[model samples]
Target chain A: GDSVTQTEGLVTLTKGLPVMLNCTYQTTYSPFLFWYVQHLNEAPKLLLKSSTDNKRTEHQGFYATLHKSSSSFHLQKSSVQLSDSALYFCALSPSNMGYKLTFGTGTSLLVDP
Target chain B: GALVYQYPRRTICKSGTSMRMECQAVGFQATSVAWYRQSPQKTFELIALSTVNSAIKYEQNFTQEKFPISHPNLSFSSMTVLNAYLEDRGLYLCGARRTGVQDTQYFGPGTRLLVL
Candidate 1:
C-alpha cells in the first residue's frame, strides 16, 4: 500500500512571507511524488513532481525537492502572495500502480495582506 | 498541454436519486481515468479507476453498482452515483492520465454534489 501524509492542516501567513508545507510518504515500491494546488472554485492543478531523489523540481514559483532517503517532498516558496491562498495537496503513486493516486489530507494556505 | 473538463460544475439531487458526471480530456489521449470524492472534512477518497480496454477497478467500500463508471474511449469517461444520499455529498473529481504514466494525473474542475 502507498500513502501520503501532509501534517499541516492549515497554514496562515502574511503577504511576502515564506511558505513551506511539509509532506512525507510511505510506499512499498519506488514512489512518484506530486504537489497540486486548488484555488477557490477551480480545479486542482499540478504544481511540481519528482521521482529522482534530492533533485528540486519547480513550477509556478513553487519548488519541492524529493528526498528518497527521508521519504519527504516539502513544498516551499521564497515569498508568499495573496493569490497563493488555496488548498495544497501532496500525492504519491507506487511504481507498480497505474494512475492510482494516494493523496494527503491537504493543507489550506491563507495569505493575508 | 492537457486539459480536463467536467460537466455541471454544481448539481443538486434528492436522496434516492442518481446523478451522473462526465470528464473529457483534450489535447492528449487519456488512457485511464480515476474518480475521487472530496468530502467536506476528509481528504480525497479514490472511488474507482477506469482504463480503456480493461476492467474497471473500484476501491474498497466503493462498488461498481453504486458508482458505475464508463470509459468508452481515450478522450471521454463518465461516472454515476446511484441512490444519492447525505453521505454522497461532496466534490467528485475525475483525473486523467496517459497510459503507462505512474503519477501524472490531470484533474478536472470537479462536480459539487448536494444531496437533499
Candidate 2:
C-alpha cells in the first residue's frame, strides 16, 4: 500500500512571501511524486512531478525535489502571488502500480494582499 | 498535449437512483483509466482501476456491484454508480494514462454528483 501525507491543512501568507508545503510519502515500490493544484470549484491540475531522487523539478515558479532518502517532495516557491491561493495535493504513484494514484489530504494555500 | 474530457460536468439524482459518467481521452490512447471520488472534507478515494485488457479492480469499501465500469476501448470509459445516496455525493474524476508510453495521468474536469 502507498500513502502520501501533507502535514499542513491550511497555510495563509501575504503576497511576495516565500512558502513551502510539506509532502512525504510511504510506499513499498519506487515512488513517482506529483504536485497538483486545484482552484475553487475546478479540477486538479498537475503542477510538477518527479521520479528521480534528489533531482529538482520546477513549473510555474514552483519547485520540488524528490528525496528518496527522506521520502519527501516538498513544494516551494520564492514568492507567493495572490493567484497562488488554492488547494495543493501531493500524490504518489508507485512504480508498476499501473497509473493508480494515492493522494494526500490536500493543503489549502491562501495568499492575501 | 494529452487531454481527458468527462461528460455531464454536473448531475443530480434522487436517492437510490443510478447515474453514469463517461471519460474520453484525446491526442493519445488511454490504456488505463482510474475512477476517483473527491468527497467534501476528504481526500480523493480511488473507486476502481480499469485497464484495456484486464478486468476492473475495485478498492476496499468499493464494490463492483455498486460501481460498475466499462472499458471497451483504449480511448473511452464509462462508470455507473448504482443506488446513489447522500454519502455518495462528490466530484467524480477520471484519470487516464497510456501504459508504457507515459507516466503522467491526465485528469478530466470531474462530474459533480449531487444526491437528493
Candidate 3:
C-alpha cells in the first residue's frame, strides 16, 4: 500500500514571500514522488518529479528535493506571485505500478498582493 | 506533445441517474488509464485502473457495477457512474500513461459532476 501525506491544508502568503508545502509518503516499494498544481477551473499539471533521494528537481521556478531518508518531498518557491495561487497535490507511486498515483490531501496556496 | 482530453467539462444529474465521461489521449497511445474523483474537502480517491488487455481493477468501496469502464483501444477510454448520489458530486479526472511507462500519469481536464 502506498500513500502520500500533505501536512498543510492551506498556506496564505504575500507576494514575493517564500513558500513551502510539506509532503511525506509511505510505500512498500521504491517510490516515485510528484508535485501537481491545479489552477482554478483547470486540470492539475505535473510540476516536478523525482525518485532520487536528496536530489533537488526544479521546474517553473518551483523546486523540491526528494529525501528518501525522511520520506519527504517538500515543494518550495523562492518568491510567491499572485498567479501562484492554486491547489497543490503531492503524489506517490511504486516503481513497478503503471500510473497508479496515490495522492495526498491537497494544499491550497493563496498568494495575495 | 501528449495530451488527455475529457468530455463534458460539466454535468448535472439527478440522484439515481447515471452519467458517463470519456477520456481521449492524443499524440500517444494510452495503454493504461486511471480514474480518480476529487470531492470537496477531500483528497483525490482512485476509483479504478483500466489497462488494455487486462481486467479493470477497482479500489475499495468502488465496484465495476457502479463505475463501469471500457478501454477498447490504446487512445480512448470511458467510465460511467451509475446511480449518482450526493456523494458522487465531485471532479472526475482521468490519468493515462503509455505502455511501459511506470510512473508517468498524464491527467486530463476533469469532468465536474453535480448531483441534485
TM per candidate comes to 0.95, 0.94, 0.95
Cα distance off (Å), candidate 3, residue B52: 1.1
CAPRI grade of model 1: medium
How well is each residue in B1-116 modelled by candidate 2, as lDDT tens digits? 88889988999999999999999999889889999999988899999999988989999999999999999998999999999999999999999987566677888989999999
Question: Candidate 2: deviation at residue B30, Å?
Answer: 0.9
Candidate 3, B1-116: lDDT as tens digits: 78999998999999999999999999899889999999988899999999899999999999999999999999999999999999999999999987666668888999999999
Flag the better candidate by lDDT, 1 or 2: 2
Candidate 3 at A31: error in angstroms? 1.3
Q: What is the C-alpha RMSD of each candidate to the true structure, in Å?
A: 1.5, 1.6, 1.4
Give DockQ per model, in order.
Answer: 0.68, 0.63, 0.72
Provide the lowest-lDDT 10-residue window in model 2 chain A: A92-101
Alpha-carbon runs more than 4 Å astray in model 2: A96-98
Q: Which rank order by DockQ, best down to worst?
A: 3, 1, 2
Ranking according to TM-score, highest score first: 3, 1, 2
